[model samples]
Target: MTDTAPQPIDLDALPEEDDHDEALTTFRARVGAFELHWSVDAPLSVVMTSSSHVGRAGVGLIEVLTSAEQRGRTSQAYWRSAVGERLRVQGSHITSDGGAERAVIVQTDAVSGLEVRSTVTAPRGTTALRIESVVRNAGREPVVLTAVSSATIGIGRSSSDLDRVTWGSAASEWLAEDRWRETPVRELLPDISLPFHGQDGRGHAGVTSHGAWSSGEHLPCGYLVRGDGEALAWQIETSAGWHADLSQTRNGGVLSLLGPTDLEHQFAHELLPGESFTAVPVAIAASAEARDGVIAGLTRYRRWLRRDVAGEALPVVYNDFMNTLMGQPTTEQLLPLIRGAAAAGAEVFCIDAGWFADPAIGDWWSTVGEWREATARFGEGGLRRVIDEIHRQGMSSGLWLEPEVVGVDSPAAARLPDEAFFQRFGRRVQEDRRYHLDFRHPAVRGHLDATVDHLVEEYGIRYLKLDYNINPGAGTERNATTAGDGLLAHTRAFQDWLVRVQQRHPSLRIENCSSGAMRADYALLSVTHLQSTSDQQDFLLYPPIAASAPASILPEQCGNWAYPSSEMSDDETAFTLVTGLSGRLYLSGFLEELRPAQRDRVAEAVALHKALRGELADATPFWPLGLPAWDAPTVCLGLRTGSGDLLFVWDRDAAPAAFTLPDVSGEVEVLFPAAPTDGSGWRLATTVAGLSVATSAGLGARVLKVRRG
Candidate 1:
């Protein structure tokens, strides 16, 4: 190892190999503001010595466990695996593009016969480093890959000082999404004073998502911060199931990330000869500031990774679901609703469900496959009239399609091959009367492709709300080695299919909805246009869900529903409309039944969202009152855009409410409804810290556009 200053790397220049025999050597690469230094042993086994963030020194050692099963292989108490210093470097290189540099290091397992390739990329002017791994089977026989590590790095401190660390994770569900809380490392893993307590830390903290729904269980993200403002945030960008583990290493703390495992999630992918499986990508960002700084860096990295998508203006969509219609949409029922949605300024009118269901059959869920217009429900002109009416109102026509599922009773179910659907022991894995379609099969993909192509070409559909309702346990064991392996392959194939669908239908705007927000992950969010934040029907219970949505998804792509009905109070209508305006306006409810005044409130919110929606594309979110608690009476969400700041203040308390906003000083004006005609006035005053806002009415919310004057 040399004591020379770090030097800049030229992409065109050849990298000088620091070849050593039975000796320790170091390899260095300058990526943006961070300097990555690797310690390579005699067998080319590399260990990250430092991944420094600017002026700070690198913290944490990445643990690599080589064995599929955890046996006593190494002295390191990191895990239950026959681990070793076994990363043999085969080759390495550097590439530059779009103000970023990527250092690709290739490694191989001599005994196990697995080729592991690591890509460490860093964008210019940022301290964020994105790391991803790909594992390929290079053996003669089949190899079962139980776990492929995305990242395993220790925190930059001693074992005794682990008390200074705080860990954060988000618990997500149907209505209760994005509930984040922090816990101290000392409390999570108590210090063990015994010398024979095994060198590893006392306990482990981890999060895992099971089945097809990636975010169904827990969010694939976590953050570790020290009391001294140093923080490390990471996210697993997988559409399928994944996990992130943080445990005690002898040094400080170690973090390991992977897409499922044999022990957890019934995941063991058997790789045939010459077959390679690319693990889910995980990103880690270092910030010397705090948890907020770490989140901001990770957000930027997410944006950079999503630069290739067919992104366009985020449009306000109206679906005839939720309280109104509720999946029973006929031509007669949808025509007026479509017209009303357009009148309310909705840019897309999606006919959700029942469109393909036969009216004769009471239940529509099971008879789902062949996506034909049920003539019994639609009448003479059929569903075309509803779509034409939507276009007539100057809105795009969107349809709901659960393209991956086929009912056992469905006509198409019998037509496709047995391999097209998920099967176990030569039997289809049935869940809730629906058999999950295996996207890995060409026949399954062909059926979905035809359905999408027909909808887009025939009906002139510009938008698609792709929904997945059921979770068929692990996956199919037929035609694959492991059920988990089969699921992972299908997940990857589904993502690839989405890209191909976009390529074929370039202008189609897809909304990723799984029952609700179950499958909301970067694997789909990175490619899809929008995400349905939640399916919470109670307007009172929706504020927290909508407020916390930006933490899990991009504000521009979060389709928060504002399902206002004619049966609600004026204040209640305003509250729901405000919820929709807070994120991407996903208008629902009985718009056709609303009175002029109620409709006007909805229109006002729509107008306000239209004015602010453009800024949402580039806006960064900040919570003045912290991330919304699921049961919090009052919630506030702030979006800092290029133009100005937009603050959403909700008063769900019994009486009047006041908010102490952070870093906001201006003459705040209620942008929606122009002036409050309901006799409720909002008072805004400047304070030393920020701004003080008090609303006259309770059980209401307001969207305030801040102007510093």
Candidate 2:
């Protein structure tokens, strides 16, 4: 291997020009694999390579320079080599148009020896260029390096005339105090103009620092910002080993790439003295749905990078037949109950808990992983009978399985022996309500894989509600030392098993539940379709829960609704049903216990939700009204598709109180669900021009449907 470094070429002597001209000499352009000398103004040239492995086009490499004068305010540029095969660039430059200057620079490295190659294309009539980078590393040594793709936008007369920037991701955050992480792009920048600042005084309020890696106390990374003025630009810097940043400035907002820092740290490789490493970064521009399209495209790219990850699709609705129909009913009994629910507007008949071998188990503390049919309770082939019954009723069957825990007296405990479960200090470790399973153990994973496969293939179960009853303990060293890779491996393996199972059935859906909503995370979201919002089933508690969820998630992925339990009042039940109607609704009650009139009320509520599912999915709730329960009357309003909309109000006590609505105007219709018929009856009154209400306080329960007139 040669120890000599390639001679550094000085870019200071490059010429500056407003446009490329044929007279330009000293500049070289290469397309695909082949290289040829050409003038600056010449139509883009094409080249082919020798290796069929390189395919028809292989990769594209271009090197160009003008007189140093045209380079503009050239900032810092330095070269460093840690692995000996790649060259890293660290610096910034200034570009100006119409007297406004913007900073731009390349934040990563260029490599010649790469497991994967990339292609670049620039079509006419587009303001932004496109680059596509693909890598497939099969070497013993992992490849480790940051990929920072940068672009410079010419300052225009107005920011509105420029392309808008939008990002696609499940979550985003600003580097606040190094320990802080925020979700949802809107929260990170409540105001579009204020830059988001970090502890080190590096971020601006309206600006978003998309990606970063901590180097002890300092953060080396990239950020993106939208330019409402004229010019927009960006920079990415990596100090130690790996980093990534994709930045763009358009009319809407600035979108960029963040996180996945751990991927670079773990997978980057080192080059032998004489070997070479290559890196490619791509950027594409679309005029419509830019953010969604970009995010979707990036998701596809990441999935391809991770070996084409695909999740099972299962859509379902929750209802009260499980607990009410026949608590732990036999297969013969449960089948009809499930069929009844299917006929009563349930698309997926979910037989929640209490269906296994032991009813004595409480709080999920025992009987997990028993995976046996309750022959006494379910009759023979009970599970299969229920599944078949659901299919016959024109619906899919979903069964609950808490595979991450085991009971002290479970058959699995005796059958697998102590070595199979997680242990600490010679004692089995317990968490929350159950004994934790050592997923790090291949044997444990194998057991779950076999069980799930059997359930899916034998019973024709299309939806599996996999519940985890315990919190993860301090993982074993064998798993922890893997940099959470063991946990990630367990997750990937579980997903891989599901994928294989899905390939066979092709209609399986998986819902992940971990002692309610505690395990809600990106990793889980990537694998499962729906998440159990929380164990708090009372419908009255949903508003607070829904509000708190935005702190960590998007509402679309969150499951919340009104569930009528045996302990609620008539007024409480109406409130619960109405509030839950605004979300992904689920029910848990005794259908037989309801009076005929009450049953009709529930049917109407369910029907309303089914009809407005599209609107609810897309609707955003305005600020809540009234104090918690402290205020006499509690009200919540959510705008539907039209400008004038619906209002839900509940009166907790007997006293009458005044209320106000914000951001609303014009005529309104207030429909009272219930009210007193006497002279002391609830009345319709208005305190403001845009506000009006119909009263029914004496009525046990009421729904005032208000619309602006």
Best by lDDT: 1
Supply candidate 1's per-residue lDDT for 127.
Answer: 62
Candidate 1 TM-score versus the reference:
0.91
In model 2, what lDDT does residue 572 have?
58
- TM-score of every candidate relative to the true structure: 0.91, 0.55
Summarize candidate 1's per-residue lDDT along 458-496 as a digit string, tens digits.
999999999998888788786666787788878888999
Q: Candidate 1, which ten residues in sequence have the lowest lDDT sum?
A: 52-61
Name the runs in model 1 displaced over 4 angstroms. 1-24, 42-84, 139-142, 194-198, 677-679
Query: How many Å off is the CA of 152 in candidate 2?
Result: 18
| lDDT agreement of model 1 with the native | 0.76
